[model samples]
Target chain A: MPGDAWSRWRAFAFFAVLLVAIAVLFAGASALYRVPPAAVVHDVHLRVEGPGWTIEYRADTTPNSTAYAILAEAADRLGFVLDARRYVAPLDSVLVESINGTRNGEDGLWWLYWVDGAYGDVGADRKALHDGSDVLWAFREYPPREASP
Target chain B: MNVRSFSLRPHKRGKVPPWKLALLLIAAGVLGRLVLWEMPNVEPVMAVALIAGMLLGGYYVILVPVAVMVGTDVLTYALGWSGAYSPVQILGLGAFVYSGFVLAAAIGQAYRPRLLFRTRTIAVMARISIPATILFDLWTAFGDWLAISRHPPMNWSLGQVLEMQVPFTLVHLASSLIFVPIFGTLFLYLHTHGWPMAGPSPSGTDDSGPE
Candidate 1:
């Protein structure tokens, strides 16, 4: 016996509609969450502040440059190791685990980044940068509200 | 018994004890989380909670999901497998996560009378899982924003937090859409047919809806 009022056709129709709705939602989210394409950057300043040490570099980067991309470029030029891992959604971006042999969680500090003195809201790879952009990667505990810069 | 024989022959009504059913559901839920730990937000706990409510009803609606979540939470924390949280953050986040699953169970409870071991019923349950998943994700995302994201290196506005949550919620919806119907049918089948290990029902009655 059929369980409820729904016929086989109705159930199929419902599932088809549900799947389409999900696909629409996925597309909308992808569009909304997408970072705008980055333009070629000239004279972008990058800084990495680790425990008792700081490294700074100024470089021109190709179009579509991101904070992480510039950091990787700087690391290659400066000969410092960049340790990171790519996580899928919800993160859907690379996480910097260590830098220059200093791993995150050392001394209760993790790697965080800021662009132009504003803390990065998205992943480093998603933090688009333009010419004259200032990028700072710092190893520190999360700042209290009053202490945030 | 063979798969065909086991599934085809419905067990005598009231043969499966409520405790056994509850225990099995809770175990399935916890194990699902443990096995799928690498896949964030893709676990059967939500489906199991919903089924528990529909099958066992009453207090089992609350007990089953809570046990699964608390059990997994404790195990993960003890093993240091999950994220680090402060005492306050733990309580705050726990409240949201726990309530989310309970709400799923509540939805199942509401549909208890209508739920049946049939294709149409399965479809309905699967459809309901979408909205249930959205609600749970939204609620917990807000909790995350409140407890963690609002502070720190990323001072995201509520809108930003919600926008970021979209992808995670989509993945969660996919997980639920797959699990709810499968688990719902399986549990409803078991409730109808009574498991082999099931002892006499404590209540000597079948409170779960008609087979």
Candidate 2:
């Protein structure tokens, strides 16, 4: 008894439908997502300097990109460690702990990021980028006497 | 002594002559597990075990996944991957993970009477696979937490452990959802075509299915 051999083809057909459903679901998800466009090249001066070493590079940052994104791109090309983490609320961006083997809290020394000669209030991961902006990351003491914009 | 015996005994029941098919399926399952070992939460062991249970019997539902895992784990160890776990931890994880396969097999046995390549069967398989996958992941994650929490570096609460593991289990769920239907249907079709079905003998005179 073939037991209705025609019924068995239902498996393949069912799998086909399943695959199509999955494809459609994924396609729908991707359509709903806001995919960022390709970055437009804007020459931004990036300087990551410490007491012992200074690494300078020029990067093409996209409009409204984060400083951390630019630094991450630079770090990958430059072969340096950019150890950062984003904690829970009130700290939802990358907090730089170390760069290029230089760590924060070594005798109270820390990595402070300055963009366009102004102290960035937000974390590096949140700082908006602009064309021709000079980004500086320095390992220095905090609580400077003069207010840095 | 009304020792009501089943015609489909492991040693008996040479009706369809399924040894070759069974061996091939077991070997294929082991090979699949080995080749796909690197993929997290994605493997055919559960689906294979379910098929084994549904077709072979409840006895094999327990045996198939264990055999697949142990066989592949041994080969994996020989190839220097060994899962990097201690013997005790391996044993513990295997027990929990195997339980999921057992549950799947049990479901197969329970549903064997009407297990066919139809819409209802597919829906049941999907439902069963989700819980089976969750059970396997939870059991394995418990094993992981047990192994990790003992180490000095880990001071995580159980809630935190589960929280951290939500993504992995979710992936496992998706994997099960995908693989269960694919393999289950394939095996079901094969079993229908006389590919050695084994399982607990259907009561009241072996209504298991066609030979």
Candidate 3:
């Protein structure tokens, strides 16, 4: 009986050590791959397309500019309305609800963005810009959940 | 009577029949997942899985969690909460999440307590919950990485994955810590009292006594 108890305790200790190791690894990864703060002005290509209208522009912004900031700047340069709001988790970030007076889910249409062609999982405000990055915001019918941003 | 033939039946009795217990657990898990679908990461299913494993033992430890996951996922897909993943993606993600829960329940089964809800029992559950939650988070995060890697524009890196996973993992851990002891204690009382069974047998039927 004592031996059994000892073995159980040993097993518990092993798992405990394992969990601690993972926690350490996670922290280390975060620190090591931390997104560097933006340095120097970044040249970003921006495209905004919606039903019956398409706009293209280029903007030079300070380093560390977020996707949302870039979008807002592009909208300003093109004289269009950009509507956005802050959302809570599991989407704890800025959400662009509408752009150029086109509303999200308006007639089965929603605002979706892609950074360099891949769907952005993190919110616009959270996605940091890199120099020469292509940010595309399209107002299109929402895709199936499989591919929807 | 042949000893082998007699051994086929469950000679050791439980407050509830194992099959029925497994069903009830699956029902609870499905309901919890549905009601809490929008909440993301904060769900009672994990605690229920652990509790079921601890009390029910044997195959129920694994089947209960898997059934709950599959059942709830079907409902989530039907209800349009599948998050736009293709059926294949959903199945892939489900595989990872299901494996995590199964591993967690397996850990719970290792408790092998003679009596439920004792101080030592709760302590052991608490100890197991931490590592189990971490394991679950890591497994699902790997699933997330797999899905994200296919995307073209998204900057995919280990650091980004870790940073993105931190908040979700923390919430999951918190949910487990809160739910395990609470549900474990409540269900322990119910099982000891023969809840959903006829009545509490004054002479306990458990073969394993306090270690």
Candidate 4:
């Protein structure tokens, strides 16, 4: 056991590095399940604002890191006009900023991702919805799904 | 053969300067950054984590940029990222890498941290992180300017490069703010839990001398 300490440190270092690398991989992999094109949204509430056309959805799923992307994505299906430049979104309407989804009361904080508002999860990325409901795309500082006793 | 002076290794003593270990850590972090360069959009948080690890591990500063080149170069080949990187690109990457490390090292060396966390006497621990991260932002911005505008001629005009990188710079700053203290806390936590790599460096560190 002369090198016992080295062996232990090696194990610790290897695992520590492995964890970071794996986390990165998972970040990449998780995007695979994104709504075809890819984005984060484990859950969320969607609300569309307009005069006559209103699409509201309480999508009990995760939300992506970029709120504008969600807005754009939702707009794509709902036929709403997206002015990205005004809101600093690209043509894809992707949010340039990284949002901490954890503030939504869940631990879905993507240190790097897209969103205008935060989400409790990224499962909201694929939430299918009905017509005329206001897609609120709500990403608050508290989780929407948690039960308070 | 002479009877005296039986030193065969690099160092004449039994233990190496702890600073060397720290230098190695920072070098490793730089390498990590390089690896992340071609991934379309490298996560700022990951970059922050890598730099923070280097700092907390007490790694050397120069290692950051050097390792970044090697790491990213290897990853590029492995990942088959299209578009060959010219000498200008390489130089640009190196300059940016240096900007990151110089700031991290300056802050680290100045603060020879023994423990993280705030007691009454340990207020400097938290304060140093802010400056360290801000300095990183400033250096990186300058590096971009120098690399594209003057040094090696780049395809991007001075204004173009500045505008293009403005967003990323903000992201970098934000991530740094989030990262520096986080890694500091992690380093402290690991040290408290008996992680061997968590120990102070073997270097003299010379907290008193000029950097």
Candidate 5:
């Protein structure tokens, strides 16, 4: 019945809202940098905390693909092999939040902040960051080191 | 003598119609594409296709993925995901996968796509994976290279471009492995359980349209 069609329409609308909300959330939470005025970024800082010593290093400058593009780029770059079930958004959030959020919560001791050296924060808008800003990445684990010798 | 008079038969009400399954699966395919961004980061279209695969089986896998790609790609460009990897390049990725998906659909049609763990099964999956991944990956990576090289300031070279691919490829592989099975298994299970809205055959084949 045409009247019964409303039910289906409502369902579609409900999901449609959900989809939009998610898009908005990602839009809201992604790491960002401004172009032209700031233009190029040159450095990011990585920090690792564990056991006894805290280590920090500067990473080379790079441009991020924004929040939406992170997932596609991340899995390809970082070799992340988890079951996303084709749902990159949720995982992407988990990833971005992991990279973007504070390195502490209730215990105030478990988290990572910033990203790939560019100062990253979920609270920061892409348009706000300037070039050469330090991105702070924090980890509880000992940071992996590439063997050069 | 009375025993000879009666033969017992079980009561049956109604057999569900095929159109119901078709409409339902089609809707699911559409919905999957619509909600595809919710899925983890694989190519958005692949997410759509995977969900559709989980819904209607591998038959319309390509179409479903393409649908999500169309939507997200539109949104992305509108949001200024432009430059060298502009809309054309993004769509090119879709075009590239079409041939592969068509092949996949045909294979799906021929085989019952049982959740078999035979060597052949793994090989079949890998065969589908290898080409499909490469096909989609090249379009995207090429776009990335173009964007970087064409950026008047730094015209990067082939090695530099390829060198830059280290991280991207890793992520793609991760996303694909993650989604493909979780989805493929879900569809297999639904078909196996004789889901009321599932396992509809169009003629002799197991199109198994969802409901």
Candidate 6:
């Protein structure tokens, strides 16, 4: 009975140690790898290229504003609808489904974004912008052999 | 403490038929996965797989989880759900994903003797779920890196992929911690009670009940 008790306690202790170690590792990695929040960016340029139409705007954005945030702001000012949906799996971020009534999968085209000439690797809500950032939302077919955003 | 104690043979005949129990588990696993499809890295399949190993034992351990994953995967692709992969990506990614569940089942099989329906056993199950989840996440993350993340457009380095994986892994850990014990207790109860009377054992009859 004593040996049994000892083994159980040992198991519990080992579990506790593992938990603590994981916590420490998570904290360390997060600190080391997490993208630091961007400072407030004045004159963040945003462009939306919809089917046969284009809209451009500039705005001073708060700190940590993502590409989606800027697009939503421009849409509000310009009076065009910015339709988006949040997807949680694969990653937690918003997908821009449509802009100004141009829905995704229409004519085999989807709304994709590029920031500073780089294709957005993450969802628009996760593609954080910095000072003088150039954000572009284009409704177009995916590039050859390219995965959908 | 003996080798025989860990042996998976001699599975007793419960009132419930092994096939029915297997179906119930597969359905639960598949449904849970579909319902939580949007919430990446959070699902009950792993927990159910582990429980399937413990309750059903033998080949059902592998059969149950495989059925759940393959069934849901087909549905996801057919329905055009998010994270639907191309045929090539499916083969590459599925190897890791399916194996993760199989590994969880293997863990459950190993821990079958300790599942005594006691408080200590519950704690033990909960504790083991952590590593099971971590292993699953790590393996699948590597798979993602190999099949998807390393490709063009993103072309993320392995370190970058791992860095991004931390949050998903944390959520997975949370999911496993919550589901493993709940399912473990539920199925253990069902096994003991032998619900849905009158069905054949998966293996040939062994009349001697669980040790």
Give the per-residue lDDT digits (tens) of candidate 5, residues B1-211: 0001111221111132323333443454445544544543344234334334323433344454454445555665565432223335445544554544333333333332333322223234433443455555565556555643434223456566555444344445444444444444344334334454765633222232221
Q: Per-residue alpha-carbon lDDT of model 3 for A48-118, expressed as tens digits?
A: 88888888878776544767778887777678998886643542456688898887766666787888766
**Proportion of native contacts kept per candidate:** 0.20, 0.03, 0.06, 0.00, 0.13, 0.19
User: Which predicted model would earn the best lDDT?
Assistant: 1
Give the DockQ-based CAPRI class for model 1. acceptable
For every candidate, C-alpha RMSD to the true structure in Å: 7.0, 11.8, 7.6, 17.0, 19.3, 5.9
Query: Which parts of model 5 have CA positions greater than 4 angstroms off?
Result: A1-149, B1-44, B47-62, B75-127, B143-151, B191-211
Worst 10 residues of 4 chain B by lDDT: B1-10
Report lDDT (CA) for all predictions: 0.74, 0.62, 0.67, 0.40, 0.38, 0.72
Residue B101 Cα positional deviation in candidate 6, in Å, after optimal superposition? 1.6
The candidate, 2 or 6, that scores higher on DockQ is 6
Better candidate number, 1 or 6, judged by DockQ: 1
Q: Show pairs that collide, candidate 3.
A: A38-A64, A118-B153, A145-B84, A145-B85, A146-B84, A146-B85
- TM for every model, in the order presented, reads 0.79, 0.54, 0.66, 0.39, 0.38, 0.75
Q: Alpha-carbon error at B17 in model 4, in Å?
A: 9.8
- Which portions of model 6 show Cα errors greater than 4 Å? A1-39, A49-55, A60-64, A87-92, A105-110, A139-149, B1-15, B196-211
Give a tens-digit lDDT track for model 1, residues B112-172.
5453446666776776677778888989989989988887656778898888787778778
* Top DockQ model: 1
Ranking by DockQ: 1, 6, 3, 5, 2, 4
DockQ of 4: 0.02
User: What's the CA error at residue A59 for candidate 6, in Å?
Assistant: 2.9
Worst 10 residues of 5 chain A by lDDT: A140-149
lDDT of 5 at A149: 5
TM-score of chain B of 5: 0.51
> Which residue window of length 10 is worst by lDDT in model 6 chain B?
B200-209
Question: Taking chain A by itself, what TM-score does each prediction score?
Answer: 0.85, 0.66, 0.66, 0.28, 0.33, 0.70
| Candidate 6 C-alpha error for residue B43, in Å | 0.8
Off by over 4 Å in 3: A1-46, A50-91, A94-112, A115-121, A128-134, A139-149, B1-13, B158-160, B196-211
